[model samples]
Target: MEFDPALFIDLFARTFTFWWVILPAIFLGLIVGAIPGFSAANTIIILLPMTLAMDPEVGLIFMVALYASSRMGAGIPAILVNIPGTAGAAATPLDGYPMTKQGRGQQALAISFVSSVFGGLLATIITLLAMPWLSQVAFYLHSVEMIVIMLFGISLIATIAARDTLKGLIAGFFGLMIGYIGADVVYETPRGTFGFLELYDKVPLIPALVGLFAVSEAFFVIEGESILSKRGKEAMQKAGWAATIEGVKIALSKWWHIIWTSMIGLVIGVVPGAGAAIAAFVAYQQSRAFSKTPELYGTGHVEGLIAPESANNGVTSGTLVPLLVIGIPGGATAAIMLVVLQYHGVTMGPDLFMESPELAYGPFAAMAVTYFIMIFTILPLARYMSRITVVSTIYMSPIIISFTLVGAFVPRQYMFDMYLALVFGVIGYVARKTGYHTAAILIGVILGPLLETYFLRALKMSEGDIMVIFSKDLANVLWVGLVISLCIPYAMQRWRAWKAAA
Candidate 1:
């Protein structure tokens, strides 16, 4: 449990010796993450044969670098084109797209890249310091507590209500119902599938996400010659290397915000069932709550862009915690790491460090080395990547629609998923035309099932008692925190109004 400064210092130095092995994986991750359908998990799965062939240390280094870098890459499309390359980057478009719309795309990209590196590096430090005891955090919150955490994320809808709370709530609840379309967990009873065989299973999220953000945005973009207007075009042309330097300056100024928001991702990610989506939303909500200019949030604030992006990468390290220390993978990506490590003859659990310190600490070393490599590799691309905004929508639209639809089908390989994506694209278009908040709806879609599953499990454990959620001290504390977080924003708004009147 003791922190060994010299030991970690040596490990850090040793990881850089593999820079030749690490660099190619970083570029691979950047490409995989930038493409809408290609997830790190899927890439890892596809490369399993090659990975298995490598020495375990080489394999883990390649996978870890890819995993960390991919988290940063997902933000690029979200900022420039309003398409989230990964589910975790869903929140990125809220402000990142807006920044792009205003010709700040290069800065947004820089901010995103820097924040991701900061978050991932800080999370590695946190993991190093707390890995001995923090893995137990998964046990502190049960299904009941997770339900509250889910609520904390969904409550972001209120913060993003824009001009109309009614429309936002409607959009959010509608997405929540859509999330429930699959068969019920308790019984095998189907709910809203309407007799489609595909509906018997859950609606696949990749297609839904692709349809909702990428496809729908493309549809709207096609209404004009370009995705940007004259002013936005002017901004895009103005994007340059200076913009990249400005972005680093902005990120450095908000260093504290990046640190704290990333810590939120780390803490939430340590819980077995929580992942980047939850961490990003919660960080965004908290960022808005504490902001002096909270009203500027959804309208393309830098804080808004950094909060979610920082949290997104912070999750990379926290995800490794439960896997290495507790033998529980937090999500599918972690599960792949777990499988690969196990296949390579690495053991998990408390004594892992004792049995094989090299294997135990190899991932952290890879991640730390990855952040160093990503800075040099990705930061310079901001100027070039930002230029995508100037491309004619006529060309961009068809490509986005075609490729994302392909991405949608990649996960399940069903023609039905392609159809489902078209359906959601129509729905997303309607939501966009209305005063409704699409981000609100998307977050709901992401969190709704987790909320329902956990709630159901908690109830079943309590023999259907409604009060089971508040039974534990930890759960009670979360209940109180959720209530306060839900109320304070409204209370602050009212206080400001009253002060203005006085």
Candidate 2:
């Protein structure tokens, strides 16, 4: 497909004309993304309803830009405080936290920002160039193929489940069960609601997600009172552009890791159901595998810092691929965008590309633009953002609780959501304390509906043949991939244990 200069010009015009809407969304996204527990997906859900009256193109561009920017924004806290604002930033803490302890906080923050911007911009280019081809591929995916892809995504849970595989599986199974609480897609029969009117719609995505990620994170924050301590003013003062440039130089030295991880991110992001967390983890593992001293990976290695940060940011554009091309959400953030698109009466799918290339390409172009903007905007503000690390838990607890409650209740205005958030907060704390991953459970929640719906539909479609899923070549390949993904982590853990014993 040839580049359409007219379309590019039109998108550029729209973005320039709607700078007011775009800038505010970008700013809000950055702020929310920087805040621990306020994830990009949740922020999109919170703000999507408000964007209903705006032009579809404007709203799409604004939200997509915000989504891309938030991935970078979350890195600030992850580097400074060791508390990842989002699961995607989890790998940042591996290296970034150590850098903070070593008084390289400014350097760490700078590296994260610069690498993130580079990864994002490069991924945007990949997205723009690949969308036409990807759209063509997406058109050929049948239900069986989609089911296989989702299974491949769900298998990632085993790898991320970490040491407590059983506990992680339990958490994931519980999440899947929770996802089934609403009406059945095929028969419209209520499953787990026990006749509660609210249950009829199934658990709302915003409330459940708020409960799982945000509320759970809040509880964890309160439990760990270290968040209340103040950093020395000297450390705060060290945040500046000079430090960032040094970090960028360090990151540039490890350019190969950045390129490969970003490529991994693009591929994963293109697959529906795989999100930023998986991308970060895969990049971290791959970086470790390729390191000259793998032992240094979790010990503040610069490559460790660069790989996952770049990869996570790279996913920002990748997630948009399926969303714009096939109408299927590649991740939770994209799911929220799906709602926004539906609200605007613009159906997502091949038709979206065929009909409204402006709406499709405008957001893609804006994402590239936002990356450039963030480098300029966030570099100068690193010191201010890093200061958030010093805010004491005593002072932060109430504010966090307030936002958690408000964010939870804002979606449905229901008190039940508040309770749900509190309950999930406790759950998250327990999971974290026990080494079971909240990310795995959240993935379950995100993919559960799709898994159940497709699995059941495939069964029904096959007239109880039960072998239809495996009968497909794509399904077989995905199943094999799932087995490998699950086994690798277990194999690695066993090898580590054995080596330690030796």
- Highest TM-score model number: 1
Candidate 1's C-alpha runs over 4 A off are: 492-502
TM-score of 2: 0.79
Give the range where candidate 2 is weakest over 10 consecutive residues by summed lDDT.
Answer: 225-234
lDDT per residue as tens, model 2, 45-123:
7666676767777777778878987888888767775556666775677678767655567778878888888888888
Residue 182 accuracy (lDDT) in model 1: 86
Measured against the true structure, the TM-scores of the candidates, in listed sequence, are 0.96, 0.79
User: How far is 282's C-alpha from truth in model 1 (Å)?
Assistant: 1.2
- Candidate 1 has its poorest 10 consecutive residues by lDDT at 157-166
Model 1 lDDT, full chain set: 0.85
Q: Give one digit per residue, the lDDT tens place, for model 1 in 267-337.
A: 88888767887788788878987899988987879999999999989988889888988799988888998
- RMSD (CA, Å), each prediction: 1.8, 4.4
Clashing pairs in 1: none
